[model samples]
Target: MAKKQKEKNNEVILALKAIVEEKGISEELLFDTLEDALVAAYRKNYASSGTENVRVDMNKETGEIKVFSLRQVVSEVNDKDQEISLEEAKAIDEKYELLDMVQKEVTPENFARVAAQSAKQIVTQRIREAERNIVYDEFHEKEFDIVIGHMQRKDKGNLYIDLGKTETILPPSEQIMGEEYEFNEKIVLYVVEVKQNPKGPMILVSRTHPGLVKRLFEKEVPEIYDGIVEINAISREAGSRTKIAVSSNDPEVEPMGACVGPRGIRVQNIVNELGNEKIDIIKWSEDPAELIENALSPAKVINVIIDEDTKSSKVIVDDNQLSLAIGKEGQNVRLAAKLTGWKIDIKNEEQYEKELQDALEKEAKEDPNVEKAIDSDLENLEKLEDEADIEGVIEDVDALKDAKLEEETLKEEEVLESQNIERDIELVPKDDDEYKFKETDETETEIVADEDYEYKVPEEEKED
Candidate 1:
């Protein structure tokens, strides 16, 4: 009988060890849990003689268990919520107060069997809950990154996704539009966010986000994942059209062709996975004009004018190309505008030309050229006054300048004649046919005026 009891004790130790191993919970943690449970149960009426003070401990090597119940000396027989009177509280610990809960240890041999079982159950529940949280925390670490899961079942119109042992919920709103999920369907999802609630940890998955598209591209295009190429931007209206801009580090490999594959096999596979949603693969450019042109594809663009401050642009197309450039109800340009974050206005070449001509006419109407020309003609009258100040027949600047030249020549001739005999200087008198000198004295005063340049001076017909 002595050996049999020892064998039974060995069995208990082995059992505890197996639980810790299988559950991945440590033996030390199990002891702490047992101690806490015993304390709680003893306080809630688990001890003999109505005193439930307990001390619980586990042997590290043998896994031996012991329990103690605790209570405080009380003077009153009222509600159990009050542990003791002020006098009794002082006996256990001097700092104890009246109506204060105090502790006095009583071994489990001092408690009933039913009370011990209740404490054991409580401890077991707590251990299981801790294990569950450990699992939740492990999976939460993988959130917001790409993940693959099997479709378990739909609950309340939401997908119960199974990531191995744990189940994640894919809410109805997050499911891809028009994409069907069969039972146990293998699928990929991008984790949008993780939220904790009273029920459990909620892993939010997405299939419609632009990030989803980018991630899908990365998965199918191995070059993207390995960092040889990168996706620059994505603009998508899921289940309809998606535009992705891709660039590459390698100069020889065309990023677009690599994505599209030979004979369009690569992109075709991606499109098939997405339920045939059309994709427009475009090369990204730093120039806004080039990007905008690429965004509105399948349509020839005449010109693109941008207002960078507001991030807006005006696209001009040929008259026959307008409808094609804008699509139905401006859908083409609208998609382009969203893709580029620019407001786009599409106009035909004729419309643009008309607008340009109208602007030019309006500018000419307000110009000061015509008014200045009229003022210049009237101002010539005052110029004649300034010229008439000199005692001369020449009132016009050009004519006065010519007269000055002639006078200078004659002065030179008279000086030369004076150096010689005065008889060489002839003062020719007018014989009706002989000319009299009527030289203009507007010589130096005309210096301030702009020189007049005209072919033949027929005053009435000349334009100055």
Candidate 2:
């Protein structure tokens, strides 16, 4: 019987070691849980006789179990289990005095099966609690970061993704619009939050988070990963479009080009990962005007007028480029506004001019120097008009000067011709004697008698 009892103690020690190794639970904690459970079981089965001072102690190294009953030393003992006479207590300890509590060993006949089962339940409960704490600590550090997981299941509109040791929730609100999630499909998600609950760690992840796009770029673009290119800002409309601003520390590196990669493979990969979401990689600039220009991309911008105090900007584009700048239902400009943190008012060149004209007129009306303001505005408008038509005006002036010179030259030539005719008449001999006449065949010729002159007469005249 002694040998059999020794073997049983060894088995208990081996079982504890196995539990510690298997569950990753500390032996000390297991022992404490087991002790508490054994005490409860002992009281339930044997302490029904009002023995309320029972305690159980276990030796961690040797796996020894002992039960003790504590009794207070009293002048007179009323309940034998709860109190002892001073004489009886002193017999056990010479220093015993009245009102002193003393312990007496009360080992049961055997460690009952019911008590062992209760201890098992306690150890199991403790293991589960320990596992929960471990999972919570593990995921708590991962909050606000990207994680890779496989789709585990879906209920209603919520998805459960298996993230190795635990599962996370991707609710409908956090899912990418128009994106389909398939079973066992590997996907990347941004860990939005981590919470502890009665069931386990509740990890909330998202596919539509702007950080998701940021992290995806960081992963795909080597420049971003190596810190050569920094992502300055990101604004995403989920499945529709996203705009990101990036800058490079190295002047030689082009931020937008680097993110775009060769033939746009780098950003294209990210776009594919995000369910074909359109991405615009813009070069960041410190100048608000330049930055706003970059933020509203794929559409040519004519100018950006900024109000530093209001942190707002007016963007001007060509009339034909208006629809592109504003995007479908104003999504482009909206995202650009978000990316730059500036209230943007986008207008075509025509609209801007009209607004500017109206504003100037309104200002002119409000000012005390209304005439002066209106005059200044008119001067500005004229200057602008002149500047626009300078080439045409210069050409017209040159053409008019040429025409006037030609008209004067024609008039002078006519005057000279008339004077020469008068001079010829005057020189044409006041006397006919200065003339010479000749006849040939049936025609008569008269000459002015000058070497430069040849004259012929008509047939009718020749008859005469």
Candidate 3:
């Protein structure tokens, strides 16, 4: 019986090693899982309350399993099963201290038989969880990148792609319009998002993303991968057309020629992969006006008037190229606007002239007085000049009248000052003899003067 038991333990160890090799699971993880399963089985079968703090220790070389019940050291013992007094704990081991966990063997005689039945189910569940974690970690690094996948099946407009180790989801919104998806068809996709689910990792991929075109260019063009060429921007109308702006870091290399490859083979490969969608490769410019001009390709741009404040541009083309610049239903200009990050308005020479004339007429209608001032003839200007001259002559005449009245007032004031008369006057002769005069009524005054002396009247006051 002892020899048979030894053989059984060896068989268990060999089986664990085989599982590690077959499932790609770490041996350490498997041992930890098995020990946990043993602990649970011991609690269920041997422990009285099934709530004891139990742990399992396994010998990695011999597959020997043992179960122990843990008891924490405390100042006072409360529960005998889980807590031990410090004195009792110190007796078992001199190094034991407070809060120290002391473990005692609790493995039952029939634990191996009971644990084997329970470990099968628990280990299988743990292995599944480990596999999911491994896959999630592997694909999470691939987010925002591109991957090649094969179409496996379609369900409710969603495509399931087989990516070797896992599957990814491709929804209808990310799919190209009018493009047929066949069984086992190989295609390139841009990984949009990676989500962790309970069952597995969910990878979301796209076919219509501009990033798909960018990654394809990077893969095809050696100049781009070497950092000699850089993609500035990309705008795509999937299944129809795409516009990509590229710039060169080195002055010796042309970005357009590098991406086009020799004999157009490089771009043609990408075009074929995208179901023959048209691609326009444009040179990037730092100037907004120049960039806007390049963004609208296949139709020549005469001028690009940029409004930096509004981030908009008005593109003027030849009259014959107007329809082509605007494209069918304005698709060309729309894609150009998105690529350049600007609002674009396209017009020909005649349309632009008409727009300018209409703007002037509108301004004239809004303010009629300004229009009248601008439209005034030479006759109207001459009438205004004559009215200004008449006003100046009237001002001169008024000034002369005011001067004549002032002169008359000055003469009157001079006469009054010369009279020096009062209501009662005392006249003194040259010999110092005094004579008195009094006024009785208006215009009647008695005058007293020296008879011997002659009385003289001034010529200026004679009238007064």
What do the candidate models score in CA lDDT, each in turn?
0.67, 0.80, 0.80
- Give the best candidate by lDDT: 3
Candidate number that wins on TM-score, 2 or 3: 3
lDDT of 2: 0.80
What digit string (tens of lDDT, one per residue) describes model 3 on residues 328-348? 888899989999999999977
TM-score of each: 0.60, 0.69, 0.74
Q: For model 3, what is the error of residue 349's alpha carbon versus the real structure, in angstroms, after optimal superposition? A: 1.0
Model 2 spans with C-alpha error above 4 angstroms: 1-32, 35-62, 66-114, 370-464
Q: State which candidate, 1 or 2, has the greater TM-score.
A: 2
lDDT, candidate 2, at 253: 95
Candidate 1: residue pairs that collide: 52-70, 53-69, 53-70, 54-68, 54-69, 54-70, 55-68, 69-106
Ranking of models by TM-score: 3, 2, 1
Query: What's the lDDT for residue 440 in model 2?
Result: 42
User: Tens-digit lDDT track for model 1 on 1-464?
Assistant: 64564565467568767888888787887767866776666657644434433577656566445664334546774644325566756755798755455655454443434445767788778777767766667667866567889998887878888876467888877776777789999977778876665555667887777887887788778788888787988887777778888888888868888888879988888888777888888887889999998888878876677778898877876667889888877767776877787898887755655565565556558775655534533353344334333323345655766676666557655764788622212123333322223213542111122233211223443443
Ten residues in sequence with the least summed lDDT for candidate 1: 443-452
Q: Give the TM-score of candidate 3.
A: 0.74
